[model samples]
Target: MKHNELKTKNELQEKSLFDKTVGRRSFLQYAGAGAAGIALVAAGCKKDRGYENPVMGGATLDFKDDFGVLNYAYALEQLEAAFYVKVASAPPASFTAAQKAYFQDIQFHEIAHREFFKAALSTAAIGSLEVDFSKIDFTSATSVLSTAMTFEDLGVAAYNGAGPRIKDGGYLLLAGKIVSVEARHAAYIRDLISNGSFADLNSLSAFGSNNAGGLDGALTPDKVLPLAQPFIKTKISAINL
Candidate 1:
């Protein structure tokens, strides 16, 4: 929780726009032409678990050194970017113009985050992973925003939790800088969905705690995998610890 400020409970009501009967054609029309492109299809395809792990398995990521940590951040950025991309693409059935623009800006921000991590990681950056939006079932506004909120909040916690684990101060600094920005993003989205409820204790952080003012649950890599599993195509068997 950001503390000392929050929206009244009565003002925090927002509706979700999901219904099984919704048609893609009408939704596309609502989303506008910029999102109708088929290129997003190359992002993912289903796979059999087989002998090799579907998620690249392991306790660590691939880069091995400082690069590995950077790639880890990069990987997370990819997930966030992909989620926002879809939100901007299909849009909610009853989305307002302002809401739509906010989502679109988030899409750009996620892409920028992804690219920035890649640029910083340099050669250590992993190849782009395929995204399986099929698993998301973004059929309505609630589905889209709630899922995004989860991921965005997860991102904030992940960075915060990972900060202390990092050995290099430079890398730590980068993570610190970026995570603050991510927290801002999280707060904005939360507010968009609910007036002034951005950093409420339930999610924004634990009550009666000093630094626990952002989010209560900070997902470790293991917990994150399952929520993210369906959307990610590449195996993530850990390589670097």
Candidate 2:
């Protein structure tokens, strides 16, 4: 199938699941009317201070409140955006023109997300994180694409897990919007790697035994941070998350 056609189909499937699980009206309600105070309230929460960073020898994630959650997301986005920036700047030798183009788009999206979180968190946002991509072979399509798939899938799951933890409705809505995009990126990358593994049980868990609505694969900060650590040189302490 063509790219647009495939994207449309994937979107329809996601919309169906989202509608069944969390109605569109409900999601809109969560977005709420006030936006100006959302970030202020998020950042004003009490913070845990004085944790050591093992890898880069700096401060660790406070994880005392919602600001910690946003900072956590900021750290992840920084890693992702950096990876994609590298990939887009120097694509693998085996990559096709279309593949390079698609990666570039993903790179732009990630950078946008990173900037958004940075701006939203403002002074509370964590500093730039140092990443270790030593395990990845950027010259090889297999390595690059595999890593991309991992990041996109992990991002989706991370957002899913963090959704309930966000006390601010506006932040939840922001996360929902971003995760939907991440899910689409996951589906697109999965399709590029394998014909139809996007929503496969092997890639994503079912909502429940009934398999009626929504999809599963949410990972809390504790579970997610460890998996992401290998690619990051900065030590993160999500103990309080």
Candidate 3:
């Protein structure tokens, strides 16, 4: 569709500006880490098959290895983005005007995140992912917000857990940047739903121990795929990383 479907797996893996996951704004802001010999991507290295924009898609993505991991993130952002977009487009009957505004901002943030990953993953990016809205219902703002909370917390911990394993400085920098922002977003939303409550910090730390950031708390591609099954229509089998 964009440039004829990525005909080969190698083409899908090739590095070009288009195959990236994060955007320039996110890249510049988050790339504070060492350069690590990686250069920024140029435009249009190779386009994905299903959509004109890399962020838009219709099929399942292949989340294998580091590429898989990035695509996994890309997919999640897609889900979040779509959810918020729906909320913004159609506010629930019970939602207050103030609540609508908050959700709208949340939608914009999630879209930014989705685009960020699309740009960052460029050619190495996965195909457009198919989602199942049935797994989630935004009609009830509380239910919608609660599901969002789960995703935000999961994203933060996943990034923190994956940071050390990244081989490329560029990738790691991107993760830290997005993860930090996600954390801030999470805190803001948590406070929004319930102010002055400890729910702000989702279960990352307990007992004041820093080293307790356990691997089990983090969802690898494999674990996340199954978790996402109910919300997605595609069969994601590439999370071998």
lDDT of each: 0.57, 0.69, 0.57
| Cα-based lDDT at residue 66, candidate 1 | 53
Candidate 2 lDDT, 60-85, residue by residue in tens: 77666677787888888888988987
Q: What is the alpha-carbon lDDT for the whole of candidate 2?
A: 0.69
Q: Give the C-alpha miss distance for residue 92 in model 3, angstroms.
A: 1.9
> Which residue runs of candidate 2 sit more than 4 Å off their true CA positions?
1-56, 205-213
Worst 10 residues of 2 by lDDT: 43-52
Top model by lDDT, which number? Answer: 2
True lDDT of residue 104, candidate 1: 70
Worst 10 residues of 1 by lDDT: 13-22
Q: For residue 234, what is the lDDT in candidate 2?
A: 79
Error of 1 at 120 (Å): 1.9
State the lDDT at 44 in candidate 3: 17
Model 1 Cα lDDT, one tens digit per residue, 1-241: 2211211211121001111101212212222324332223112111210112123332247534555666677778887877877777778878899888777766655564565555454443467766666756676887787788877777877776666556667567657766776777778778878999776656454212134543345555555556565767676655444
